[model samples]
Every structure is written in C-alpha cells, then in structure tokens.
Target: MPSETARELRRRLHQQQLISAFGREALRGAGLDGLLQDAARAASEGLDTDLAKVLQHLPGEQCLLIVAGVGWGPDVIGVVRFGTDLASPAGFALRTGAPVISNHLGGEGRFRTPQLMVEHGVRRAVNVLIRGEAGAPPFGVLEVDSRDAQEEFSESDVAFLQSLANVVGLAIDRDRDRRDRDLLTREAHHRVKNSLQIAQTLLRLQLREVEDPEAKRQLEQAARRIMTIGAVHERLFSGPAIGLVVVATYLRGLVEDLRASLGVGDGGRPLALEVTPASEEAVWDGDRVTTLGLVATELVTNAFKYGRGTVTLRFEIAALTGGGTLVVADEGDGPPPGFDQAKGGLGMRILTTLLRGGGLAAERPPEGGFRFVATLAPPPAGNGG
Candidate 1:
C-alpha cells in the first residue's frame, strides 16, 4: 500500500494534470457551453468524485440555473434551479464570493442540501465561485459532489475546483472578444461595398449624360471596375468563409454581370459567354480576387469589342504547385496584324500592368482564335489550404 504522504502527492499530481488539460482546451477557444461542460467533468475527475455541475446565476430570476454537469439526469441539467440565498451551499459560494466545503450535508446546519442532490443520495459537496474579468459581474458557481456517505470534501478539493473555475471564466471572456472582432470586420466590409455601389451608380449617371464616344467608353470601364470591387465585398460579408472568395462562384458572377452590361455583338445576337465549372475548393485572398476580376473584365471587354463569336473563360488548377491559370479566348480571326501585349491600347496596358510578374501567354489558338492566359500564384499559407 502507498504511504499516506505518497498518496497525497499522487492526488496532487492528478489534480495538476486535470487542470493543465482543462487550461489547454480553454485556450483553444472552445465555445462557452462546451467549456462549461468540460469544466464540470474536469472538476469531478480531479477530486475522484461521483458528480459535478456548473450553475449560471440569473439575477433576474434570483436563481442559479444548472447549465452544465456530469453524472446528472438529462432533466436535472438545464432544468434544475436553486435559490440565491445563503441557505444553499452553491448559492453561498456564489453570493459571498467564497468557497464552500460541505462534507456532512445530511446533518449540516450552515447550509441546506438542494432537494435535487438529496434525491440523488448525495452526502458531500464543494463549491467555488466562477468569476468574470475584473469589473465584470460574477459568472456563477462550480460544484462537485460525492454520494459515498464516508466521502469527505477537503480543502485541497476546493483549491482544485477554484483553479478550474478560473479557467472557465477566462475562456468565456475570450470567446466574447473574438465574436466582437468578427462582427466589426463584417460591418466594415458591408460599408465599403455600399460605398462602391454608390460610386458605380454615379458613374453610370455621368455616362448617360455624355455623348462623346471616347469619354463614354472610359466612364463605362471605370463603372465596371467599381462594380467588380463592390461585388467582391458583397461576397466576403455574405459567405461563411472569412477573408476568402470562391474562385468559381466569383468568376461566374462576374461573367454574368459583364454580359448583362456589355449587351450583344455586331451581329445583333446575344454575346456567348462560356465559363468552365470549378474543379476544386480553391479560394483566393481579396487582393488577388480584385486583380483577377479587373484582368478578366479587360480581356472579356476586348473580346466583345474586337473579336467575334463565342467567348470562353476557363480556370485550371496546377495539381502539383497549387497555382492557377486563367484562359480567356474568343472565336475570332485573332488580333489584327502585329498586335503586341506590351505595346497595345489602354486595355492592354492594364493587363500588362496586372500580369507583369505573373506571366501572360497570348496566342492565336490552332483553331484561329485569340487566347490570353494569365498565371495566378497560389494564395498564402493558412488560406484555403
């Protein structure tokens, strides 16, 4: 048999191990309910007890609600309530901000054993207050229980429970902070999107009042660029993936919008736009999406103005390197004689600027059509990986 001193050391070591594990989960940002449930279980296991619970104080109702627990009936957890007065052991710890050790609840005079505990044949229990950050209201109480009549709740057990309670408080606080930051980021995106939309609307009004073909074309191009940015922001705030734009969804939407704005070809027939289906769960950062959007708009616009027949836009993922390729082609006799990418018009200048280091491939496909291929580097690590 282990000596009394060695046995005490073993219990302390076990308690420290439980505390360390609970602290890690809390730091990992587990949700509030999950943290509370795990805290209850940890408290019970730390003390080798039969049951444990975490009660959230509802000041409005003047009662402690059993929000999480271990070894309790489904009806008891989330359904049981205890008064806040000092007569109750858990209440005394919560109301007075002190730990309570009730080892002789059956004959105790200091506090009453809750009826729910009595029904379960509980003979001893310990309670500790779960406090919030400084200046914040107290969260509630954490309690562990034992059913063995010979079981004793010691001061060491109270210390372990308090340590677990502190970790729970910090986790809840950090979770709230993270939620607040996320909300603020979403709000900022929404505001920027609305502002861009307003700018696009103003540009469209200016385009309507002008009659010079040159000026009208410039304004129209500017409006389209603004629209692309606005659309990207809309997707960022509207979707579940944070700071990411789905490659397929974004390109498809952009092609449809451009088709609506640019209208039909010289043959009085609707312009044909073919978008290849997305093959992977690939995503890109906002800046990359914006650059790609602008490049696509320029190439597609040029195809409609100079080329003829169906315009096809294809996206391919490099399987080994995780990079991407954008292929924009049109069924035409290709660019007129002597067309150079680095020495062309405004559209060509924009394309060259955007694809400077990214590598651009322009050729007349074997079938006698113009094709512009842009290579996109993979997104940074931790984004859509």
Candidate 2:
C-alpha cells in the first residue's frame, strides 16, 4: 500500500501532467474564450479545488468580469463582480499581490458578505491575483473554492495557486499579442491597397497628357497592373490572415480585370485566359504577388496588343525540385524568331528588369508564341517553413 505522502506526490504529478496537456491543447484551440475556460478547469484540478473562477478586468466597464468559471451555478457565475472598493477581499488581493484566504468564509470579518458563499456551499476560499507586467494595472484575479469548511489550505497551496495564476496571465498575454498582430497586419494591407489605388489614378491622369500612343498604352497598362496588385491587398485586408494570399483566386480576378481593361467584349468572347495549377493551392507573400502581377500585366498587354489569337496563363508549383514556374503563353504568331526579350521595347525592358530584380529569369518559349516563364524563389527563413 502506498503511504499518504507517496499517494499525494503521485496525485500532484498527475495534476501537473494534466495542466501541461491542457496548455498545449489550448494553444491549438480556435478562440480565447475556449482557452480561458480550459485554463480555469485545469487550474481547478491542479489546485485540488471544487470550483475555480477567472475574472478579467474590463477597463471600459471599470469592473472585473467573470471570463471563465467551473463548478459554479450560472446565477452566481454571471451575477458577481469585483468593484473598485479596496476593502473588498478580491480587490485587496489584486492590489497587494497576495492570496486572500478564508478558512471559514462565514466567520471571516474581511470576507465580503459570506452569505453568498454560504448560499453556494463554498465554505473555504482562496483568491489569487494575476498582475500585469511592471507598473501596469492588474489584469485579473483567480478564485478557488472548497465545499468543506475544515479544508484549510496550506502555504504550498497558496504557492501552487500563484503558479497557476502566472500560467493564466502568460496565456492571456499571448492571445492578446496574437490578436494585436493580426489587426495591425490587416490595417497595413488596407493602407497599402489604398495607396496603390491613388498611385494608379495619378498614372492614368499623367497618361492623358502624353502624345506618344505607345507611351500612353504602357502607362495605362502600368495603372491596370497596379490595380491588380491592389486587388490582392484588398482581399487580404478583408480576411483574418494577411500574410498568405490565394494564388488561384487572385489570378482569376486579375484576368477578368485585364479582359475588361483591354476591351475584350462580353458574351464569352474575352481574351481566352486559362490558368493551370500544379497544385490545388499556391500561397505567396505580398512582394511575390506584386512581382507576379507586374509580369502578368506585361504578358496580357502584349497578347491583347499584338498576339494574333487567344491567350493562356498557366501557373505550376512543383515540390523540392527547386523553384516553381509561371508560364504565360499567347496563341498569336510567335515573337519574331530569335527576338531578344531583353532588347525589346521599353515595356519589355521594364518587365525584364522587374523579373531579374525578383531573382527570376524571363524568357520566350522556343517552340512558338510569346511565353514569359518566371521561376518562383524559395521563401525566406522563419516564414511558415
């Protein structure tokens, strides 16, 4: 038979394992609410308490709101609030960074209206403070309750509760940091998209004054290219994650816009743009999206202006055999045999410069037609690798 001390040690080890498992699972959970509830339940188990409650300070309401609770009736869970009164045990615990303990809730003078505790059959209680970092206001409080009046909590119990409070504080902070980063990223994408639109508008206005038709055409194409990139940013701004972009959806929208901009009439008679995917999904960063948009704009513009027939855009992604390829082909009379893409017109020169700057190679397919093939570079380290 195991001694009481051995059994207690075993129980503690099991509780610690449970807490660790809960923490890992909570990180993978969807929202903060679920994590908070799971943390409270785990803390209650680790602390050997019948009930646990987590109260978060609501600055706007100027009060502490119950974020999670275990073993508490709905009435008590939703009805209690810790006001700003320093005399209150909950408030005092928060201010002093000390756990408030009441061996006998009904008889403790400092216990705030023990009638509520009696009504809930909570005879012994401990209140743990969860303070924010360095001079910041306290974030919240954690309370544990026991139904047995004689169940006196020891100093080790207080220490354990404090450790649990620390874990809860860290979890809350991590969730808040994640949410803040996501919001900032979305806002940045929105501002960038708006700036791109303004630039595109300015380019169009400048094109109106140019006497050279080719220059004007290039300017208009540049504006359309900017708009296409802006559309990708717009999609990101509307989504929860701004870092990953959907390649297929973005390309389809860009193709539709190009058809409209080039005056490809309706009734299914637009520039025959077809995109073949090497994978079901290809996600890219903002810079890559911008480069791809510029390259696509140049190819589509060339096809509409000079290609004799329909145009096709193919997107392919292959695993590990190095970089992927983006091929834009037009069924027009192929570019003059042995024509150099680098020595072409101003637009072609700009396209070549952009591709090379992006660490990509641009070339015409030797078989026929005008084909712009760009190799996709590997993503930088520490980015979802």
Candidate 3:
C-alpha cells in the first residue's frame, strides 16, 4: 500500500485536474444556468461530498437563489433560501467572507430549517462564499452537505474547497465581462448603422435637386460610400464578435451593392472587387472601417467612371520596413499625376480628414492600378474576430 503522503499527493493531483476541467467546462456553458450546474458537479467531486448546492446572491430579491443542486431531495434543497436581512450562519458566512461549519445542523443557531434538516438526515454541512475579485461584490456561495455527522472536515479540505470557490468566482467574472462587452458592441453597431442609414437618405434626397450630371454623379458616389459604411455596421450587428468587422466579407458585400446600384446587370458584367488578406482574416474596429470605407469609395467610384476593364479591390496587411501597412488596391487606371489632395474638392477633403483622424497615412500605389495604402496600429488584444 502507498504511504499516507503518497496517497495525499495523488488526491491533490486529482483535485487539480478536476479544477482545470471545471474551469473549461464552465466557460463553455451557455449562461448562468450552465455555470451553476458545472460548479455544483465540480464542487461535489472536488470536495468528496454527497451533496452540493449552489446559491447565487440575488441582491435585488434580497435572497440567495438555489441555482443548482446535486444529491439532494426537493424538500431540502428546493425550499431552502437565505434572506439578506436574516442572521443565518450561511448568510453571515457569505456577507463576512468566512466559512460556516456545522457538525450538527439541528443544533446550529442560524439554520432556519433545523427540523427540515433533521427530516432530510443532513447531519453536517459547510458553506463557503464565492467572493468576486478585489473591489467587486460577492458572486455566490457553495454549500456542501454530508449524511455522516461524525465526519469532521480537515483544514486541507477547507483550503482545497476554497480554491475551487476562487475558480468559480473567476469563471463568473469572465462570463459577466463577455456579456457586458457583447452588449456594448451591439449598441455601438446599432447607433452607427442608424446614423449611416440617415446619411444615405439625406444624400439620396439631395441628389434629386442637383441638375448638373457631374454634381448628381458625385452625390450618388457619396451616397454609395455612406451605404458601404452602413454595410460594415450591419455585419457587426449580425456577427458574433463585438467591435470586429471582417474585411473580406465587408468588401464583398460592398462590391455587390455597388454593382447593383451602378445598374450593372448580369449581362453588363459587373465590377469585380476581391480582397486578399495577408493573414487568414483581417478585423478592423469601427473607426478603421469608416476610414477604409471612404478610401474604398473614392477608388471604386473613380474606377467605375474611368476604368474600362474589370475592377478588383484587394486588401492586405504588409510588413513595412518601419511598421505595418494596410493596402487597398484596385485594377483601374492610376490617379492623375500630381493629384492635388486639397484641391480635389469635398470628397478628397473628407478622405484626408478621416485618414488623419485614424492616425494613418494614405498614398496611391506606384504601379498601373489605383492603390491606397494606410499605416495602422494593431487592434486591442482579446477583441477577437
């Protein structure tokens, strides 16, 4: 037989494995319900207990809700709730960031349902508070019960269970963070899309008043640019990731819209816009998309007006000698030599302002086609595509 120390080490290793698995499973779970279920199961296995119950602190209700329970009857777990104002041991433990250990539940002064505890044969119990991080409120509580009244919990047992509670707290915080981020992202996208739609409507109405064909054409081009911005926002609202719009997908949709808007039917051979990323995917923030959309509008609009052959738009992140460069290229005749940035009128001025606002430098490609290159900073970490 193995020595006591060897058996203890083996048990701790098993517990560590359980904690790691629990953390992963908890994160993958859909919502708070899934998290509660995972926590209960993990707690039971990690603490070697027959019964485990998870109680989330619902401050609005002024009570601890029994979210999940394992190895317990409906009478014992279902009807048990601790009020915030009540002086129960469990509540006290949670409020004070301490642990409550009762070898005999019937004799415990703070248990509200001593007779129920006796009826259910819950002889001993322990409740630990799952406190949140520094400066945050408590997340919840973990309650473990055993039928054996004589079984006394060791200090090591308490420490191990406390570690499990810490993991639970971390999981809860992460889920909350993810939810808040998603909400903010959705709101931002919704507002931007609404604003762009309004701008498109205004531009379309203004186009009707302009008698000059050239002026009407310019107005229409500006409207199309606004529509492209709206398209980016639409993708952001529909996609799963917050604050991230896929460059290739956004470009493809924009090109298709441009083809339809320009009245290039199936037989007419629509302008082809293709984006090949340097990486598998390129994710841009709202500000970046706004700047890039304007640049794309200028290039694609010029292509439609002047280019004879097919028009293709490609985007790639390049490793510049100094830093990274975002290149937007199209298969069209290059801009006129010495193209005046300031004298090219409102469109060029808007493009210049947007690029400068995003802390980027834009220039045309040296080869035959029109290409706009902008140097951009890396996006924030964890803003996944």
Candidate 4:
C-alpha cells in the first residue's frame, strides 16, 4: 500500500489537472450552463466527493437556485432553492464570501443542514463563493458534498474549489463582453447596409431619368458597386462569426442576386454563373471577402458584356500562404488580341483599382475561352476567421 503522503500528493495532482482542464473550457467561451455543469463535476471529482452543485443567487428573493449539479435526482436540480442567510451551510459562504467546511453537519450547531441534504444522508460539505464583476453581487456558491459520514475536507480542498469558482467568474465576464461587442457590431452593419440600400435606390431612380447612354451606364455600374457592398453587409449580419465570411455561401447569394437583375447572357441564353468549392465553408476576412466580391462583379460584368455563354468563377486558396487567386472565365472569345488590359474599359479600370493597383492576367485557355486571374494577398489571421 502507498504511504498516506504519496496518496495525498497524487490527489493534489489530480485536482490540479481538473482545474486546468476546466479553465481551458471556460476560456473557450463555452455556454454558461455548460460551464456551470463542468465546474460542478470538476469540483466533485477533485474533492473525491459524491455530490456537487452550482447554486445561482437570486438577489431579490435572497435565495439560491440549483442551476447545475451532479449526483442529484431529476426532481432536485433546477427545482430546489436554498435561503442565502448565515444559518444555511452554502449560504454562509455566499453571504460572507468565505470558504465553508462542515465535516460533521449532523452534529454541527453553527449552520442548519438543508432538508434535502438531511434526506440524502449527506454528512459533510464544502462551500466556496463564485464572485462576479467588482461591486456586482456574488454569482452564488459552489458546493461539494459527501454522503460518507467519515469523509473529511481540508484547506487544500477549499483552495482547489475556490480556483474553479474563479474560472467560472472569469468566463461569465468574458461571455458578457463578447455578447456586448457582437450587439454593437451587428447594429453598425445594419446601419451601413441601410444607408447603402438608400443610395442604390436613388441611383436606380436617376438611371431611369438619364437619356445619355454613357452617363446611364456609369450610374448603373456605381449602383451595382454599392449593391455589392450592401450584399456583403447582409452576409456578415447573418453569418455566425462577426468578421469572417464564408466565401462559397456569400458568392452564391451574390451571383443569384446579379442574375436576377442582369437577365440573360449572350444569344439571349439564361445568365449562368458557376462558383467552385461548392462547400458552404472556406472562411476569410470580411473586408477581403468584400473586395473579392466586387472584383468578381466587375469581371462577371465584363464577361457578360463582351464574352458569351456561362460565366465560371473559381477561387483557389494557396495552402502554404493562405493567399489565393480568383479566376473568372467565359466561353466567349476574350478581348481582341494585342488589347492592353491596363487601358481597357471602365470595368477593367475598376478591377485594378479595387485590387489596390494590382493588375489581372488575361489568358486564352486551350479549351477556347477567356480567363482573367486576380491574385489576392493572404487574409489576416484571427478575428474569428
């Protein structure tokens, strides 16, 4: 048999491992209920106890609600409450913000044993307060209980339980901060999309009044650019991640919108748009995705104006660098041989401008159609992408 000292050391190590594991999940922003459940389980396991629970304090009622627990009947968790006064075991920890240990609850006189605990035959319990933001009311108590009448809890056990409680507190604060920022970001995107839609509507109205073909075309192009931006905002607003854009999903929606507005392609055929990487994933930065969308629009518009048949858009990610290339191809013959892309039409100019002075490479594939390639810089890392 191992020495008592060795067993104690092993227990301490196990408790530390539990704390680290729970800390990781909490920092990852797991849902509040999930965090509470995890914390309760960790506490019970770390203390070698048979039961554990996280009690959420209700300030107005001066009571604690059993929000999460382990080794409890279905009728108890989420259905039981305890008074938050000095007389209650867990309540004493919450009210005084101190750790509580009751090794002999049955013989104890300082605090009353909860009726549920009495009925369950729990003879020992340890409690720690889970704090919230400074000046905010305490969240509630984390408690570990044992039905084994002889089981004992020491100071080190209290320290481990307190560490777990601290992690829960930090996770609550972080989750709240993240939600607040998301609300602000969504509001900003909403306002910008609304403003852009208004501009697009005004441009459409002006387009109907203009008689000059050149001015009318310019206004239409401008309106389409604004619409492209609006479409990006729409995608961002609906997407789960705040700053990341799923390339395929956004592009498919954009292509559908363009097809609706532009009508048929050459020879009066239906306007056909094909996007590679059919999967709804492949995320990238929002701003870069917006730029790619505009670039695609200009290229697709050029294809419809000069080329014919289906317009195929392909996006390829550079596995090593994260940068990628956007290829827009059409079945029709490309610009006449010897044509200068840098000095070509307005669409070409806009493409180069959107790409930050970078130019596209024109190619005639062996399959007998035109292909334009625009290389993009590697998207920035992080930002939820």
Candidate 5:
C-alpha cells in the first residue's frame, strides 16, 4: 500500500480536477441565477460538505450577499447578507485574500459566527475569498462545512476549498464581460433608433414642401427606406445575437412593412408582395446587413412602383464565401441597361461596388419584367454565427 502522504497528494490532485470541471459547467447558463446555483452545487459536492454559500461582495453597501447556497433554507439563499468587518474571520479572510477556518463555533473566541450559522448548527467550516482577474477585486466568498459537531477541517481541506473558490472567480469574470457587452449593445441600439427617427422626421418635413405630386411621392419613398433600416435595428436589439444578424428574418419583416407602406399602385390597385427563401438562415454583421437592407428597399420599392402583378423577393446562400444573395424581381418591365451606371447616388454606389468583383449582380432577366439580384459581400457572421 502507498504511504499516507502519497494518498493525501493523490486526493488533492483529484479534487483540483473536480473543481475545474464543475467550474466550467456552472458558468454555462443563460443568466446569473443559473450560474450561481451551478457554482454552489460544485463547491458543496467537491468539498463533501453539508453546506456551501457563494457570496458576492457589495462594495457600496460594505457587505456580502449570499447569491447562491446549498443546504440552506430557500429564503436565505439570496436574503442573507454579511458585514465586511476586518475583525470577523469571514470578512478578514476576504480582505486578506486568504482562507479562515473555525474548528468549532461553540468554543471559538477569535472570530464571531453569524446568527444564521449558529441556528443551522454549522460547527466547523472554512471560508475562502473568491477572487476575479489579476487587476480586479474579489468576486465573493465560498464557505463550506460539515453539519456534525465532531467534524474537523484539515489544512489540505482548506486548500481544496480555496481552489474551488478560485475556479468560481474565473466564472464571475466571464459573466461580467457578458454583462458589459450587453449594456453597450443596448445603448447603441437606443442611439441608432433615435437617429433614424430624426432622419424620418426630416424627410417628412421636406415632403410637405414639394410642388409636384411625383416629387412628393419620391420623398415619401425615401422616408420609408429609412424606416426599413430602422426596423432592422429593432430586430437586432430584440435577439440574443451580440454581433451578427439573421438576414432571412430581417427581410421577412421588411417585406411586410414595404407592402403596407405602398398600399395601392397605379390606379389604386391592391399591391401584393411575396418572399421565397431557401429555408436556411444567413448571418451578417451591421455594415453588410445595412448595405443589403438598403439594396432590398431600393429594388422592392422600384418593383412596386413600376411593375404589375405580384412582387416577389428571392434569397439564396453561398456557403463558399459565407455570404448570401438576394433577388428582388417582378413581372413588370425592368430598369434600362444603363440604369446601374447612370445613377451614382448612395444606393446605386452600393450596387456598383458589389457588381465589380462579382460580389453582387443586377440584371433584367429576359423572361419577364425587371429584377435586381445582388450578391452580397462576404460579411462577418453576426451573433447568430
């Protein structure tokens, strides 16, 4: 048989592995609540203790919040708070970035135990400071103990608990990063929404001063185009994707809005629009989606204004370059051949830029009316990717 010292070393190594595995599993969740519970579970099981608490430091309040716990009353999990006095063992351990142990609270004098701990019969326990990244402050504390009065914690047990605390600390860092990114994204969405509203208001204001009916109609179209792009940002903010956008869903909603905007076309006839997709989703970043959205608005609007019968939108994916293609086609007569080069404005410029390297293509298929088929540039896969 192996010596006692060798067995102790083996035990410590096994506990380290267990802590690492559970730490990662705990961090994988939709939000903070799930993550906390996971971390608490990991700590309790790894330490073979009856109780464990994952505490969060509340600097502003100068206290620690028990965010997660195992083997405690349900009411106490998020309800308990501990003062951060340096004189107290738990607080001192947090302040000094060290571990503190109490063999038995019944006869202890150096540190005071909380009223809740005494009620729960927490006889012997160890507290370790859960720390964050190198420059950051501690996340909280991990406390574990056996309920039995006969239990005694050794130095190796304290070290094992401390390792568990460090594992949870890294998870806290990841969660913090996610929260920061989400906050910035929401702020960006709010600013963009305001800017689009202002642009729409300006276009409407200009529309009221036009002398010719045709000019007024053109200005109205411009306002609607801005609204289409605005709709995109709205959808982006609603979904979980941080950096990418699902192009198919965005176009579906945009098509519906386009139909409503141009209710009647030429002689007050009801206008109908349809979209055909490959049933697969495509992801793209902000700039690329913006470009594609603008292109679709121009083509779909042109089709409704000048074409007859039903208007259809077609979408395809190009797996090779990780981008996709969109075709806005109608049965009506197509734009003149020189139409692409003659109009050097913003919308046309987008098309011209894409058409050169075959990233986009526009053509009037000889079979029917007009069609603007654009092969979008290979854009970054957004949050969905």
Candidate 6:
C-alpha cells in the first residue's frame, strides 16, 4: 500500500492540474466575473477549503469586491463588500507582493481579522497575490479559509493556493487584453466613419448650389457612392471585432438612408424599398460591405429611376457556393431593346468595373421584370463561419 504522504502528494498534484485546466477553458468563454467564480469553486473543492473567493480591487478604493466566491451564502458573494486594510492578510499579501498564511487565525497578532471573518468562525486562512507584471498593480487575491477553529494549513497548502491564484492571474490578463482590443476597434471605426460622414455632408451642401443638370447628376452619383463607403464603416463600427458582420442589420440602415434621400412629397410617390433578409448567420467583412453597397445602390437606384413600383432587395444563402447572393429586382420596363449598355455612362461603367472583381449577371425573366444578381465572394480569408 502507498504511504499516506505519497497519496496526499498525488492528490495535490491532481488539484493543480485541474485548476490550471479551468483557466484555459475560461479564457475561451465570456466575462471575467464568471471566470473568477469558477476558479474559486475549483480551489475550494480541490483543496478542501471551507471558503474560497476571488477578489477584485478597484483602482480608487481600499476595499475588494467579492466578484467570485464559493462557500459563502448567496447574500454575501456579490452583495457584501469588505475592506483590505493592511491589518488583514489579503491586504498584506497584496502590498508585499507575496502570499500570506495564518495557521491559527485568532492566535496570530500580526494582522487583525475583520469582524466578518470573526462572525463566520474562520480560524485559519491563506491568501496569495493574483500577481501581474512586475511593478504593476495586482489583479486581486485568491483566498482559502477554514471556518473551523481546529483546522490548520501547512506550507504546501499555501503553495497550492498560490498556484491557483496564478491561474486566475492568467485569466485576468487575457480578459483585459480582449477589452483593450475591443476599445481600439471601436475607436478606429468611429474616427474613419465620422470623417467620411463629414465629407459626405459637405458634398451634399455643395450639391445645393450646382445648377447644370449634367453636372448635378454627376455630383449626385459621387455623393451616393460616398454614402456606400460610409455605410461600410458604420456596419463595422456596430459589430464585433472578429470581422464577421451580420447582413440584415447592415443593409437595413442603407435602405433607410436611400429612402430619406428622396424628399417626401417632392418625389412622385413615397417609395417603399422593401428589404427581405434570409436571416442566415452569414458574415461579411468591410470590403464586401462597400462592394455590395455600391452594387445594390446602382441597381436599386436604377430601378426606382427608370423601372417602376416598389424596389425589393434580397440577401440569401447562395445555392452553389460558400457565399451569399444579393439580388435587386423591380417590376419595371426592361432595359431598352439592344440598349448600348457599354456606353451607359459613369454609373454603368462603375458597376461593370466593380463586378469584374465579384460575380454578376443580369436577366429580364420570361415572366417579366428586371433583376440584377451579384455573388458576394466568400468572406475574407479566415473571416467565415
């Protein structure tokens, strides 16, 4: 039979392995609070500690909030807050950048046990700093305590607790990095989008003065194209940084912008631009948004200007490829018989140039109306589901 010492050694080694795994799994999930909470539970159960907790130290505060805890009743985990005065071991470990342990809590005179600990009958404890970079602030403390006065903690117990705290520090660092990246993404998106919007507004203002019909038409086309780029930034701004974008949410806003451009009561009738999304989880990156925006704008604008009735925009999963298809169709006169499309002016040439990079086809369906279909290339490399 194995000696008692050998068995205990194996158990603690197992505990460390389990706790380390928790950190890796938590990094793949969301939210810092829940991650810390799970660490507390693993520490408590694996180490046979009566109370385990993960503390969060606010920048300007002297107290640590119980962001995650195990063993405490529901009323205390998130609801109660405690001070981390130098007199308490948690504060001592944090300040000294080292772990602290009290084998017999009440007998120790070096630190004062808070009243909450007294009320809970905690008689022994060990706390370790959830250490961060050297000279930087600590993440928080991971504390394990024995409520029963007879329970005692040895140096190995303290060492195991320190290892658990280290795992938690890894999780904290990852969460902070993700948050910083998200902030930068939002900031960059806002700057680019805002600048484009300002330029677009200025162009619209200048448009109010031009008198020649031909010049006005050319300027109007430019403004609409600028709006397409602006919409790309807006879509990217509102979504996650992973580069996958929701299609319906993006296109709906573009549709509204087009409708608003046509002044109410000034146009022949209030245009009802209907948008039907297949509602798949298809995602597109910024380039695709700008390209499709221009394609949809040209086809739909042409429909409203020359075709007739309500314009319908549809996005659906393409039947054949790893991409989606965007269709702009309308109930209107087909292109003039044998019309000279090659000479169809600026917008037509622009549309043709854009499509060569994508996939495009046009048809006057035997049943009637005009339809222009474009295939959005599969999301940028590494950007798809």
Best by lDDT: 4
lDDT scores in order: 0.83, 0.71, 0.69, 0.85, 0.74, 0.75
Best by TM-score: 6
**Candidate 1 at 210: error in angstroms?**
1.4
- Candidate 5 error regions (>4 Å): 1-3, 22-35, 59-63, 73-75, 83-89, 95-98, 133-137, 148-151, 212-222, 260-283, 316-322, 335-349, 354-370, 377-385
Task: List pairs with backbone clashes in candidate 1.
Answer: none
Which residue pairs overlap in candidate 2's backbone?
A: none
Give per-model TM-scores: 0.87, 0.83, 0.63, 0.85, 0.79, 0.90
What is candidate 3's lDDT per residue for 36-115, written digit by digit as tens? 77777777777677688888888887777677878867764546666654366567667888887777666767665434
Off by over 4 Å in 3: 1-46, 50-53, 57-100, 104-123, 131-139, 147-150, 154-178, 267-269, 275-280, 316-385
RMSD of each: 3.0, 3.8, 6.8, 3.4, 4.1, 2.6
Question: Tens-digit lDDT track for model 4 on 101-121?
Answer: 999998999999999999988
Q: RMSD in Å for candidate 3, one decimal?
A: 6.8
lDDT of 5 by residue, 133-196 (tens): 9989888888886677775777887777777777677777878988899899878987897899
lDDT of 6 at 312: 77
Stretches > 4 Å off in candidate 4: 1-17, 24-33, 58-63, 73-79, 83-87, 107-112, 265-268, 277-280, 356-359, 380-385
Model 2 Cα lDDT, one tens digit per residue, 158-266? 6766766776667667777788898888788889988999999899789879999878877887788788788878766433356766666777778878887777767
Clash number for each model: 0, 0, 0, 0, 4, 0
